[model samples]
Target: MNRQAQAVVLLLLGGAVLKASFTDLYLRYVKEGLRPFLIAAALVLVVAAVMTLWYDLRPAATAEPDEDHGHDHGHGHGTGGGHHEPRVGWLLILPVLGLLLIAPPALGSYAAGQAGTALASQQVSDYPPLPDGDPVRVAMLDYASRALFDKGQSIGDRRVVLTGFVAGGGPGGEPILARMILSCCAADGRPIKLGMAGNAPTGLAEDTWIEVTGRYSDRVAKDPVNEADIPYVTVESWREVPVPKQQYE
Candidate 1:
C-alpha cells in the first residue's frame, strides 16, 4: 500500500476511536476509566495521519532528492523506480472495516456463559453493617460474597436490592442474576452471579437487565469456589429496568 492509503486508514481508525470515546458505544466495550486513554490514543493516531498528509503535500522541490536517484546501478533498489509496497500494509483496513461495516455488540450472555461464577475477594472478610433502607441496594458481587463467604451475617433480616442482567435459570432451573465485573476493561471482565429462589418471574430473556429486591437464603455453598453453585436470594419482588450507564462494577 502507498502512503496515501496508510494515511486514510489511520484517519478512519482515529475517527472511529474518537467517536466511540465521545459516545456511549465505547462503554459497551470498556470501563469508563479508559475513556481518557482512548481519547488520547485517538488524538495521537489523528496527529500521525495529519503529519503524513503534510509530508505528502509539501512541495517536492523543497524536499531532499532521493540518494538512490543519483546512483542507479540497476540492482532494483533505486528511488527513481521499481520499489514495491508490502502487501501486509493492507491488513490495516480490517479494523477500519470492522468499525464501519461490521461493528460488534457489547459482551453479554454469550460471554457470560463461557465464564465461571465470580469469586469472592479473600482480602475482605469483614464488612460494615448494611446501610439503612427498605430494600438496601447492594452490588451483585458484594452480595454474592456476603452470601457465600460470610453466610449472610451482614445481610441479617434486612431486605436488599440487586441489579444485573438475567443470565439463566428462570424456568426449569433456579433463576440466576449476573453482572460483569471488570478490573480494567471488558476484555478482562468476568461474570458475578447470584441464584434466586422464591417467585422470580419466568420467561425473561437472557441479557435482560433488571432490578431485584430480595433477602439472602440459608442455601449457600459451604466451601465456595469459582465453579461452586451461586448463592441464593429469596426474591420478594422484581421489575424490569433499563441497563445502567456503567454496565460493569
Candidate 2:
C-alpha cells in the first residue's frame, strides 16, 4: 500500500470509531464506560493520518546522479532504498466497510440460545433486603441468584418485576426470561435466564423485550449446590416493552 492509501484507511477507521462513539452505537458492542477510550483512540488515529499526509505531500529534493554505482541499470528491486509494503494492510478496510454497510445488530435471542444460562456461584454473605415497592424492579440475573443461592429469603412473598428478552421455551414449553451479561464486549457475553411458571404469553416473537411481574416459586432444587436448572418465576402478569438502550446487563 502507498502512503496515501494508508492515510485514507486510518482516516476512515478513525471516523467510524468517532461516529460509533458519538451516536451511542458503541454501546451495542462494548460497555458505556469505554466511550472515553474510544474517543481518545479515534483522535489519535486522525492525528496520525494528518501527519502522514503532511509528510507525504511535502516538497522533495532533486535526485543526484548515481556516480558511486556507475551502472545505469534501473532495477527497482535493489535493497539500497527500496521497501516492500505488505499486502495484508488491505484487510483493514474490511471492518470499515462492514461498519458502514452491514452494521450488524446487537446480540439477541440467537446468541443467547448458543450461550445457555450459566449462573455464577454466589458467595455466602448477608444479602440485602428487597427494596420497598409493590413490584420491585429487579434484574433477571439478580433474581436468579437470590432465588437459587439465597433460597429466595430476601424475596419472601414480595412481588417483583423482571425485564429481559424472551428466549427459547415459550410455545410448547414454559417461557424463559433471559438477559445477556457482558464483562467487556459482546464477544465475551453470556446469557442468564429464569424459567417462568403460570400463564406465559403465547406466540411471542423471539427476542421480544418484555417486563414480567412475578414471585419466586416453591419448586426449587433440593440440593442448592447442584447446578440448579434455571430458577422459576411464578409470573402473575407480563407485557411487551421497548428494547432498552443498553441491551446487555
Candidate 3:
C-alpha cells in the first residue's frame, strides 16, 4: 500500500489502542505486547504524516524515486507496485468515524454484579496497614480481596476513599448502596460498595454515579444477588460524580 494508506491503517490502529486502553474490554482481550506496538504504530504514522506535509510545503526540492532499485519488499516492507494507488491520508478519518459512531458504554449494571473466575488464595503479608491518620487511596478490588482473605483483620477504624455508582436500595428498605462493576479481569476489578448511612445525595438512584469517602470498615453483607464472598466497605461520606468510563485497573 502507499504511504497514505499505511498512515490511515496506523491511525485506525492507534485509535483502537487508545480506546481499548481506556476500557475494561481491552485488558480482558488484548495481549500486552501487541498493545504497545499498536500504540507506537499510530504515533509513527501521525509523525510521518506531519513531517511529509512539512517537507512538501517547504521550498526544498523533492528527490527522485530510486529507479535502479525494485520495490523494497524485504524486512517486512511492502512492494510499491506500479498499480498501487496513491494513499489518501484523509482516509485516516475512518478512525474518527468509528469513534463517533461506536461510542462504547461504561461498565454498567450488566457487569456490576458479575464475579470473576475463582478467587486465587494468596498470602497477605505484603499488605501494609491502613495509613494511621489519613484515608488511604486503594483500588476497590484490593480492599475487598484483603477483607475476604484476612477476615479477622480490622480496617474500619481508618479512612478509605473509593469511586463508583450508587446502586438501587437494598432489602429491608435499608439505605441505598453505591457500586462500580468490572467487565474484565477480577484482578483489576471488584465493586467498591458503600452503605449509605446518611441521607443519600439528591438525584441518586440505581446506576447513578458517585464517589464515596470513608474509613475502610466492615459494612453489611453484600446483597444476596452478589454471589462472591467479597467484603463491603462502610462509607463515611458519599457524593455524586460523573460515571467513569472504565471500572477496572
Q: For model 1, how does the per-residue alpha-carbon lDDT over 53-155 read when each residue is reduced to its tens digit?
A: 8898788754235655543445456455644479898898887677666656667766676777767455465977889988889998888888777778999
lDDT of 2 by residue, 1-249 (tens): 888889989999998889898985888888888889999999999999999998988897655577434444554456366354798998999978876766677888887676646575555745799888899999877788888778899889999999998887422354578889888888998887777788666678889999999988865432122343567889899999998988888
Best model per lDDT: 2
Ranking by lDDT: 2, 1, 3
Question: Candidate 1 at residue 152, lDDT?
Answer: 88
Tell me how many clashing residue pairs each candidate has.
0, 0, 5
Cα lDDT tens digits, model 3, 134-240, are: 67676665566566666526464666666766554343345344344344343444444444544345555567666767654454454545433434566667777
Q: Candidate 2 — worst ten consecutive residues by lDDT sum?
A: 220-229
lDDT of each: 0.78, 0.79, 0.53
Off by over 4 Å in 3: 1-37, 41-96, 114-126, 152-156, 169-203, 219-226, 244-247
